[model samples]
Target chain A: MGRSPMNREDTTKNRILAAAGPIFAQRGFQQATVREICDAADVNLASINYYFGDKQQLYIDSVILAREQRAQQFPFPSWSDDTLPEVKLRKFVGMLLKRVVVMQTIPWQVQLLMREILNPTEACRQLVEDYFRPIFDRLLRIVDELAEQPLTDLRRTQIGFSIIGQCLHYRFSAGVISLMVQEDQREECFDWDELTHHITEFSLAAIRNLGSHVAVKSSPRTSETH
Target chain B: MGRSPMNREDTTKNRILAAAGPIFAQRGFQQATVREICDAADVNLASINYYFGDKQQLYIDSVILAREQRAQQFPFPSWSDDTLPEVKLRKFVGMLLKRVVVMQTIPWQVQLLMREILNPTEACRQLVEDYFRPIFDRLLRIVDELAEQPLTDLRRTQIGFSIIGQCLHYRFSAGVISLMVQEDQREECFDWDELTHHITEFSLAAIRNLGSHVAVKSSPRTSETH
Candidate 1:
């Protein structure tokens, strides 16, 4: 059977979104024009207005679409009920790093999300709630299990931010990081497994120390008498 | 002897640099124009070329000038030789948060540095070496003192990155974070004292646990058989 009218409209919409993602990512919301998106998508100018109503709506949809596409392509690893929390945490960190740094198949989605982060537009709140909050909750659950004591919400939030901050640093400051370290060491630090291991171990050590059983020995180097 | 020729030239150079700092910070390097800077400085068109050679050099000088100005204005807290490493780390994290988040006296410098970080230009290398390297070294030294065992260069680097990452997150993602959490919680989090305290404790705990004496307990909640 031939494609129905609704199918043709959906195809047109998908084409526009596909074209708009990269253009919006590259030029940002202000610089990116509907004309350019339409031209890139090879659709008529009316088609954009007809399908998306306006540029702002188009942008919001594009961001959501990018999130959906990335989630589908590189879904978070599934862990069975028997899996250890530490193992799950490790996998979570690795999945984050891989999706962010290694998955080159959808570079625009990452870039768009990052740009939204650095200079968020109206769409940012939706992006955060829809895309980031779920992942953050997942991380918090894993951290809660790993912690020796029941963590306060504030402490849990701080711990979650710490883990995410480490992952994001590699993406934002990869250039500066490479520049700061020696050439030989850059590969080792940036290597997917190495960075993931470092973050997991660092976080785990800290979480374990939060327990009352562990006495955090004061530095011997401290000259002040306690 | 009124203003000498050399003194007059220096004043003109200073004016251009001051005017350019905000413009470059506001508009970034590419969008910021020489004419606007010259106008803002109330100098002749040719003065930019005469003083700083060109727009690119002028941008570099302005960044350097902003760095020097900020450093002088809000110098990092100096620790006495007898100061405890834990205290030093707390002070370090506090100083960083104050400079990045609370110090409203010179907002442009932070914005300019952040813009450079997101979309680094040719000046990024110089920025990293001249500004970041010294701070990184200081942090490494502090972390070294805190750790019970001697950290490898890679571990030290990772530790330094972890600390810096936590501090930087508040500045960059403050908007998203505020949106993520409840309104009442926002004040507690963005409170300079609270954020600094959280980061310091979190990092210190992690560093202390890295010692050989501390046994990292496996997650009690894990159901998996090891």
Candidate 2:
């Protein structure tokens, strides 16, 4: 009976976070209210303060939860010493595309995380070293293996961003693309399998070519600065 | 003084459209008010409709003006028949990256057009046929010239998007990127010249490889559909 009070507290906190994610995503932190979140969770007004300490803390927790849930759903596969970086890249893009798009109605948690990344709040400063840096580090390593010649740090970082930029474009530019592209054309590229395959092949082909071409182009002075 | 009335009317209309561009861009079509725009221009309340017909028409004109001003400032360079498509592509990307990112405080017009693309409104459907279609056609042609072999329409379209997507990401993902990339590393990729060079090289490499690699991977049935 004593432990049940603690269990109830846990349930209430979780419920508040569940309700807060969509509201924050929809309205943004500046506009979303604690009252609205409490209303959505069907909890007492005082429960949020008692559980998470404050609204900002609740928002940060919601962002973390969104990231954590996606991580579990599409957990990174273990790679052996023999696994090809190209293959790892394809798998990585596939997972990211799945998280970013594909679903008819995107899950709220995914939207919240995507929004956080787009206009990151104070939460991101704290989270990036822990979350984004490691993921970014993994991407850079994959790009490193794909390149045959030694890439300067800045050049390698650009390539990493180029691959990610392609994926992000599909998610953020849907409205623009829809107006520009024919419906049939949209289906062909936007299809989950087709997009993953295209991004992987495009990045691979570029990666294979970058070593010889860009090394001559990148100035030593600039590269050394970075 | 018969002509003075016509000139005054022209000035008022121009003033309203100029004022509306930033307001609509900042607040978006749904949130921005005609009252705010009138106040900004320091014109009477009735002057808006008298000049532009209605708020919707006013919003559309603001979008068109934004596109036109950027076009005039950064007019596409004319190419001779012998000019290589790769050169053309590089020039094209350079101009675009300039419009999208290089300006210190992105001119209000540029921001308005970008917002229109991301969450297109009634203005887009009308503008797409006249404005966007020609630009898109030019991009597809550039890719067509660069491709050594025949590409299916869907394939060509995807390639076009891949180039445009890379450019769009740099504009939209600045906050996320700033958090992930170090300040020193950012200058290497983000300096106007550096980004244009990287995108062109990356896209060209991918285009050169596409004929052999993607043709085999693209199913005949899917390619035939579009």
Give each model's whole-structure lDDT: 0.79, 0.78
Per-residue accuracy of model 1 over A1-226 as CA lDDT, tens digit each:
4545563365888899889999998787877988999999999998988988989899988888778777887788888888899899988888888777633243898888887787778888888898789999999999988987777777788789888888888877666787899989877777676677777777877777765533342342322122
Q: Which stretches of candidate 1 lie over 4 Å from their true place?
A: A1-16, A30-58, A102-106, A213-226, B1-13, B30-55, B102-106, B213-226
Error of 2 at B5 (Å): 8.9
Angstrom error of the Cα, residue A108, model 1: value is 1.8
What DockQ do the predictions score, one after another? 0.36, 0.37
Docking class of 1: acceptable
lDDT of 2 by residue, B40-133 (tens): 9989899988877888888888898888887788776578899899888987787778878734566787778777776577777766787667
| Runs in model 2 lying further than 4 Å from the true structure | A1-13, A27-39, A43-61, A218-226, B1-13, B27-40, B43-60, B218-226
